[model samples]
Target: MAAGAPRVFVSHLSGVAVFDPNGDQVGRVRDLVAMLRVGQRPPRLLGLVVELSTRRRIFLPMTRVTGIESGQVITTGVLNVRRFEQRPTERLVFGELLDRRVTLTETGEEVSVLDLSVQHLPARRDWEIDRVFVRKGRTGSAFRRAKGETLTVEWSAVTGFSLEEQGQGAESLLATFEQLRPADLANVLHHLSPKRRAEVAAALDDDRLADVLEELPEDDQIEILGKLKEERAADVLEAMDPDDAADLLSELPEDDKERLLNLMQPSEAADVRRLMSYEEHTAGGLMTTEPIILRPDATVADALARVRSADLSPALAAQVYVCRPPDDTPTGKYLGTVHFQRLLRDPPYTLVSAIIDDDLQPLDPNATLQLIAGFFATYDMVAAPVVDETGSLLGAVTVDDVLDHMLPEDWRETEFHLDESDEADEDNEEVAAHDS
Candidate 1:
């Protein structure tokens, strides 16, 4: 495992003794069950489980798990043992409420909780209860501790969470993209403050960061590029499509842009400069350099062999582009694409061109965005080839790029907006959407 990454399954819940705030041994933990948070799926803890005597199970919010030790489980507060004797209501365990959506009474508005605030109590510490709190969402809300309200119950009431929504002065931004579409992610980024935008950009893995960057508007892209460290910015630029990289570089001041270009690999720098040489908003300027090219005379077996040998980009699909002789056109004359699955289904000796779709639509180097959009809509293509006037293929434009242009400037705010009344409606909508 890499440094700072936790070792999975090294410690299990079985055989660990449970203790309350009073330091009384309640029972041994038999198992640990955790659910993903409201907006975070397959990541982020939601809740945990503790097994007690009499074969009863106790459910605890993730906030309640104060600490995990070699042989002990410490909770935030004391709980009545009787609470574990009965099964929890289905609503508490398997409904929208558990997802972190709740109604705020003050404005009759709904707010989706990112996480619950809980007090942590550790044994042998200087103070009885740890001042540092564990929370899923933004912490330090003065209204979190209203008089006479049970913290545990209030924490448990959470159901869903808002991303870019809650008018928090744009300080909160959704940075992760585990389950978000590129459009949704673009929306979330649009609402974040400059600092929060940097935080979000820093949190994303390279591929996702590249995806979101490719989707951002030119102005927003410039702002984000300015905030990132030189090294980090270089890394993101290296991971982006060549045309996108060139476009972003073109937006930078001459000095910074030249410095970044110097930092890139010679091949990458050359590709970006070539793309940038074209007029902005044209097909040649917008196309990606990493096209799946193969020899037209090659057999399916030979093509497959090349595919296996080459280091293909992870973002590419299963289709490979077959081109004419390099001597005829340095960039290789435009041919057609062949789907890997189709090639696999055919005889190995079959010629690549025989199996490829020769009638595939191609884009001219100077095609406008409106023309590109119309072509994409008409052909339903994930990508389209861009060829020079001499019929030599240069690059291709992907659907993801087109989708980036379709999102509105205020899209990010839509994700974070949460009102009390919308909580129930939004939860239902999310559930229905997920189910479908």
Candidate 2:
């Protein structure tokens, strides 16, 4: 783990209240889900099993989580309220891991699992088990173990928790392709048999699956999505970019589309619903609702901070949209845009409004695909804000999205190429590891 990566002991998170961005309490963290890897590899943190105020237990994908501060957990407010069902590959940290017996590799001493620590992998949203807190004494109640030694050690120092050495399946396949980019993984999935594609899709964490889905062909997207449980399908959609999710939903049968939409959190569904209200090729339909938004009074430093978010795509981070109030889309009257270059040129304390590029006219929500393409070409802009007739900032359409529409519908399938030798080398290594 990196020195400064966010690390949290599972004990501290027990029963912590989870709140939405609006400060509304949603639930409490009941347990965490993790996937065990083969051999001694640290398990991957999957998501949280939260108990909502309504006494409903739902799974909260860590991708939707924004912060884990003192005594509380913060979310992006886009939760899927479906009951959490454990898969054959998933283990609950609180229920299945704690109080278990594990052995210290160095001295071969058996100990009781007290807690496990998870840390975010550097520069990525993925997290993993990196350390274990154990008690070096006879396993029993807390009082019984009072005199025993307790210490935290690296995950590799402990035995147990990982999958069997002979383990082979979708997760192992996923391990072989762990370093593959989302686009590459999507291509792999695209070429796989339907059963294999669905198997690997089921093994992927929600955020990862969402990213791959965005890169996949529409047919593959629908096939993989149809194979997922309806509740899980809704959760995956919620994790996807709003515009992309909306596009996928539009392609589904009307009954299926409405059902999944209804299954989603209201806040997330509303964004998709709003986008679906527009023509397929229009600016309103193509724009992502989660662009970096700021108020006119926000300083250049603040804009830079938003731009620096690792979650943003390059085009979305190319500029910050300035609005009046209400920082989220359909934000208050559109003020202007502060391109990244302008923010870099100004002092940190300079207000964004003073550096706004209001001279360039914004795109209309109903702008045609040809018009949108022309605007991008004419201004040499990678992204352009879309404003409604009421002057509220709806969202910003990026150049990539415009190109996606203008390209042949089969472009994603046509351009993807998988290196056969790379797969063979990885497969050979996989066989060698399991054979030994």
Please report the candidate that would top lDDT against the real structure: 2
For 224-317, candidate 2 gives per-residue lDDT tens digits of 9999999999999999999999999999999999999999999999999999999999998899888888987889999999899888999999
TM-score of 2: 0.59
- For model 2, state the Cα shift of residue 292 in Å: 0.9
**Tens-digit lDDT track of model 1 for 1-436:** 1222232231244346777778877666533333233432222333334545443345554445566655567776633332222122112121111223345433444443332322222332211111111123332221232122222224333323322333221111231124566544664465444655665566566667787887776777888888778877888898887877987899889999989988888878888888888787777777788876778778988877756743444334556777876622227777788877888899989998898887866888799878988898897667787888777878777776665555664443233333445333333322321222
Give candidate 2's error at residue 398 in angstroms.
0.6
Clashing pairs in 2: none
**TM-score (C-alpha, index-matched) for candidate 1:** 0.50
Runs off by more than 4 Å, candidate 2: 1-168, 416-436
Q: Once superposed on the true structure, which residue ranges of model 1 sit more than 4 Å away at CA?
A: 1-193, 196-208, 215-220, 301-318, 325-330, 406-436
